[model samples]
Target: MISPEDYNRVKDKVITIDVRTKNEFEMLPHFDWAINIEFSEFISNYEHYLRLYNPDNKLIVTVCNAGNRSGQTSQFLKEKGIDALTLQGGIYNYKRKFK
Candidate 1:
């Protein structure tokens, strides 16, 4: 998992995928640049994700309201040979630390 400080240091060099549901995402404060991909959609369309994000090309960071979902998603991506990391403590920690 990546700490908010570490993420902030490399924010410009990484792609952040927020896996929160649409309703949750719309109602919460999130990074303006994060890509909103609902967790279910990401799981269902993993091939599409693989096509878009290449481990060798860019770092992938998964996020959610808390770390749980993102952690699971990161594991799934890694099992599929994609290098992915979760935001430690997710957006809540990020907001607590940086916002």
Candidate 2:
């Protein structure tokens, strides 16, 4: 798992997965760097992310509103044999600290 500060240092090299509902993401302010994969469809489409973005050992940073969903997503990815981890606090924290 990467700290928000550490992640920010290499933000360009990381892929941020926002595992929040599409509506939730839209309702709040937007984050250009994040890709939304709603919690409901996360498990089914996770493989696609594993295949497309960072297929061959690329780093992934999973994020959620406050970290719960992203934390779960990290576990799911780890179970699937991917080296994925969660963002410490998620977008709520990101916006507060960075934006």
Candidate 3:
């Protein structure tokens, strides 16, 4: 399992995938470097976004508002043979524990 501490340790080298709504991301405090894929957009325009991401540059970490969606996304990527992990408790926990 991916731990927040470890995530913090390697955050700079990791690619954080924010799976929250665009409005939610805009309203919240989060890592500045995180990439937003907004869940709805991800569902409707997945291929387009995937093509835009350079997954080779960093280790992938999928995160949702709460860990649910990220976990599901991570599982999908893993099954497709992509290297990815989820932020264990999502941004809510990040706000509580790290922010």
Highest TM-score: give the candidate number. Answer: 1
Give a tens-digit lDDT track for model 3, residues 1-99.
478888889888877888888887898766678888876666567556666785364568988777998888878778767678999888888778886
Error of 2 at 9 (Å): 0.6
lDDT of 1 at 44: 90
lDDT measured at residue 57 in model 3 versus the true structure, 0 to 100? 42
Q: lDDT score, residue 28, model 2?
A: 80
Q: In candidate 2, which residue ranges exceed 4 Å CA deviation?
A: none
Residue pairs whose backbone atoms clash in candidate 1: none
Model 2: colliding residue pairs: none
* TM-scores of all candidate predictions against the true structure: 0.91, 0.87, 0.84
Clashes (candidate 2): 0
Alpha-carbon lDDT, every model:
0.87, 0.80, 0.78
lDDT of 2: 0.80
